[model samples]
Target: MRRLLSTTLGQILAIIGCSSVATFLLFIVLLSYFGSPPAPPWPWQNAYRVAGLVESLRGAPQDVRNTIVAAVRRPDLSVRLTSSPSACSRQTLDTHDFDAALRAELPGITDLAVRACTSHKPGETIQVLVPLDGQTLEILTDRTSGEPGRFTGPFYSALIFLCVGVAAMSAWAISRVIRPLRQLSEQADAFGREMSIAPIEEHGPLEVRRAAHAFNLMQERIMHSVQNRTRMLAAISHDLRTPLTRMRLHIETHRTDIVPDKLIQNIDIMQSMITSALAFLASDTDRETREWLDLGALISTLCDEYAEGGAAIRYDGPEQIRFFCRPEAIRRVLTNLVDNALHFGRTVTVSAKVLDGAIQVDVSDDGPGIPEDRLRDVIEPFVRLDHARNDRPGSMGLGLSIVKEIVQAHNGTLRLINRHPSGLTARVSFS
Candidate 1:
């Protein structure tokens, strides 16, 4: 029953069906109590009642007829003797069978006038008048609507029935409207525990569809973020171990404790990795907040810093290229690309450009480019290219993988292409 009621059609039918049956039951109770409305006194019953009253009056003396009428009179009825028939002021009822049934009981009467009192209030008042030996006898009483009272007949019954119908219809309509939202809530509960569930379907009214669409987007983004963080932790750990291993081996080999230039670079590299990872993880913006920055200025500063370190690097393209992006994350991406290029190639040239509505930056190196077959594998985390670049002091094959992740986080794309003759270029583009 719970499963059935959860559906739209089932709820609608149940509501309407229950209300209808309840109304019918109510009507039955009213009928049994008030004895059928509007047409209460059956023709034979009314005929017998009127016939008995008339026969009693006819047999009683003129003086005692008034006493008999008074004794039999009720609040809903009035029986009196009159000298003229028009004194009752009653209209004839349009029931031929009732008139014939009355005649069948009272055959002695030649002039029979059934006068009915029309009332707009509660019970129906019926008047039956007949001519006697030298007087007129009028019997006035209720025919239908037992006991003269308001809210007792078919009118109130119909009103109650109508209210039931309207209530049922309203309930069904509301259920249909909120059905999608209910599903949304259920999906949210299910996905809250395990985000691997498939996205809920977007449907229903326009506003509801928009809400569902937003939920789907949030679900996808949260799942992607979790997976990305998991990968980042594993990859960063693997990368950090490389430097730690080198430091350990150096510590073991040179027992005299002389820190060489290559050993210092590895320490610096490990420190940089831990610092960058902490900053990325602890950032309030989840990753980093995007803001407008001068791409050319950033690249120029980086190249100048590399040059200051006695590394051959140059900056090309426009002097100022303003772009919107996460400053720290994008800086990391560019730094990784430039470091990788410097390790493999003789000199690194960083270029920036704004074409169409997008920003493009390329870090090109004039050295042996990566092989076509290994280009795809080079982007995987902890995947080192089988080339001479692996001989670099602090290279752990994390540069391109880090660059790829950062680029993707910025809603950008990264591509590695072999330059003509003898070079490689790493291109990053964003709109």
Candidate 2:
């Protein structure tokens, strides 16, 4: 049952079954309390039976009437013939809603007398009465069942056949609907753990086919982006190396302390760029296992380390905020955000806390923040804002992209917002 309920077809069938039972119960309630009892078997079966007996006994001789009663009586049914009045024995005060139904069945008859009366034996009953030519016929029958006569053999058969037909149609329709979604989910799971995957087939309803098509396009775009980025990195590596080679050759020919110090700074910048580029292409953070860590302390220690290195960085918020994520990946994200902060701003403030049922960490900097228009673009790969702010060495524009990828892998979001006057806040939030 548990396995059955897990599927869409089973759930729908369960609902139908429950609804059928509810409807049946409602019918029983209406018949028992609020309305009249159901007609027995057919609409006018009892009336017709009594009418047949009346027709046979009309103006018959006394001996003939007795013969007919003996011939027609059943084990549960009895018939009586009399020309006497007051034939009913101890009539009870039961409601007579069925009297109108009896009259309606036999249009030829204008009036009929009927009553409920006690029986000699426990199962005997007063079925009904018939009036004939100067005679009365009383029908007494044994009660067939102690329970209410609500269902018949044909009714049960119909209900079973109806349920089977409905279940078959529902299972077919639901299976057709669930098939594509299940395939899409399986493909997604495989792709997240894999880089190269064949495109998923687009089939099903319009929305499902469209979603599959969009996913295929996204995979192609990502594959293209990776190839383009690798080519760009190779070109950049050669271009930057030519100048460094010449600068080294110059230093060898004419050595000066000042020249070498400035040149070394440029060399450091070049190395930073190369390292960041290679790391971005490798995306090693994707393979890390997730674990719970004290994010608050991690930010605090990172701020103190930067502060010791003469950068104006501070940490705030709680002492411990346990968050589930890849520690190294989160550290990489923090490293990139903080690097951008120190390069552009004079001071950096790193804070972490639980906000709105999510783990939120904000790295704010009082630097010349990114232009409002370019905030979104800065997060994309290889985007540099040279015109918006002063040129920072080794700013290859891959840091935020790496950060975004790592955050997304953890099912988190990275949002860059410019401060009011002159700063930016990088907010990382996840539940």
Candidate 3:
């Protein structure tokens, strides 16, 4: 479950959902502020009062209005008053005058209780509703006379600038955190495919850096263990071959008429087992012995060898097809297949072809094919389809297992399939 949520799409959805909720709350607050009635000392109304003061003092005899307006327009004032009423209505204002105008313009503003502001002059103060429209007071001034709140447009413009800054910073922070996590996930996938996974840089937060360090350590340990095991197996197999060769020479020189034919057959079986085990051990250690091999020639050679030994085997396909692989491993895999086919079907056919940028080798025999249910099960190590079929005594079922292991080591696959015309087919492919 944690893995599922850690996916890129999942993380994106979570971010979008959270941001959407925040945006919705902001929207609701803005909507309620604009749509609902004003509070008792309405803040918006105070804006209108300042507008009225500026209007009333616009051309006064004292000349104070002109002096104040000129001063307010200077850059130091940092205030902007637009000619348009819609622009001016949104300005933030001084709390004192704003509240006085709010109370005066909107006596019923207490019912909304949205927000409040007030303004005073000596002992007298004005509290009136902020004008929602430029001419609303013009329509209501005859019914209930009062000053309205007003504001310069600069206040709202500054707020817009601040919102834009916040949004950009938020995006930058999110990307900084998510980038390292994305790289980590990609490295994990590459590791799964057995490719070289570059170590993640320990440049993020402490937790992320620690995770990358641990992953690098684990990979080093695994590589060391594999190399150690391969070396040990190679040394043991090499040592045993010398003793086995000496034993064979000694046995050949003996003149033992007392020994029955069955005993001689048993000795041959033992030799075959030792040879198979040695071949596997050698292949495991000498993985770098790859060559540009003609696959068709290899198949034909194995078929001809078996035919010379009285096995009914035939080769098919083109005169040549080539690939890069360990020729010894390929030969061992083909030999295993052909031997199994001859034991079961009496006649075996080997073929090779190049298809879909891959080399395919098929070894098939006309015999009682495996049951459909046991097709996959038969390929497992030492899992002979039948424990009872013993035309050859001391037959172990490691042949197919070796074939599978070799093919897999070369980044290939092996499969057992039922042939349409007759028996079972072992199909192997190398890319």
Candidate 4:
């Protein structure tokens, strides 16, 4: 019940039910207070008329009684003088508006009876008795057949139609309000997953339209900020390259005698680091279009290339599995992970498998894995483990960072885990 009330349809239905009931109750109150506009004269009114006419004949001459009987009598309504009162005494009459009207119109009369009865001649009739000069006067008229009150048929149909129309209009308006919000939520998620998502359409109620417009502005600003940062980094990397090249030439021409071989190696490593950093920054700005590609084949080809280069690498998993992604970005991610594994460990094993509607690619190596505490830290730029600080040459510690960036750009996750018993595992998963 609680869950039902949470939905739009449920709330609308509840409103319709409550409003309809309230409206009906209001109509009932109005009817009770004002009553139905004067209907045809009631049976009791006819009976009262007969009583008034009969009283006129009381103690009158016989000729006057005969004349009134003839004047007031008709086929559907009749006035008669009878000797017996047994017919009116047999049945009890239900009190209604007619009874009240009769009492108000005939206040002085003491003995009177009004009842409904069926007779063979008339089928149904109202019998009235009035005491007239010691003789019981009987006035019988055709009973008024109850024509069901006005609040029926078209009246109820119109009410139902009105309620239905109100509910329908309310639902449409609510949906119009909710649809844009739902679209905004979807666009927000898409923006998080892919930076290139289009802006939300600004159309709804005033507040919702304002919110959408604000969201679009925020997205534009974020993209602009990232692009500006990337451009600045690229320019700095390019400027540093010219000086580094001139320094290399100077060292070769004159400083060779004084500079140790390690000094030259350090210069080379710095150049490599500069190149890698430039590449890292440039990758973000790459307008690489995405397409469906066979992920298994991509991993297999990477492993094969490493094997051709005499690296101890092995490939595992299905032969082919197509997935939508940026191919170059994914290739770079896989290449970085594979190169890192080969550098740190003796042998590398690349594998891919489908799990829970996503593709999971695992690159495992028989190397000393990162400590649990440092696993997250290692993925940040320029973060190197204590062991790799001196031993690994030309290592700027940006390989895993680049890998993480690319994976996240594809809306995927990259994590480094220590394998059971031995070795480190780099797991990249994408849906």
Native-referenced Cα lDDT, model 2:
0.75
- Candidate 4: C-alpha lDDT: 0.74
Model 1 lDDT, residue 296, Cα: 86
Give the best candidate by lDDT.
2
How far is 57's C-alpha from truth in model 2 (Å)?
Answer: 36
What lDDT score is found at residue 92 in candidate 1?
36
Model 3, 117-197: lDDT tens digits are 223222222222323223211111110214333222564455444555555566567667667777777777777787445
Query: Where does model 4 exceed 4 Å of error?
Result: 1-268, 283-286, 387-391
TM-score of each: 0.54, 0.50, 0.43, 0.44
- Which residue pairs of candidate 1 clash? none
Off by over 4 Å in 2: 1-218, 227-231, 234-242, 245-253, 256-263
CA lDDT, candidate 3, residue 170: 62
Best by TM-score: 1
Between 1 and 2, whose lDDT is larger?
Answer: 2
lDDT of each: 0.74, 0.75, 0.60, 0.74
Q: After best superposition, candidate 2 residue 406: deviation in angstroms?
A: 0.8
Worst 10 residues of 2 by lDDT: 89-98
Q: Residue 140 in model 2: shift from native, Å?
A: 54
- What does the lDDT read for residue 7 in candidate 4? 73
- Where model 1 places Cα greater than 4 Å from the true spot, the runs are 1-179, 236-254, 257-266, 279-294, 322-333, 367-413
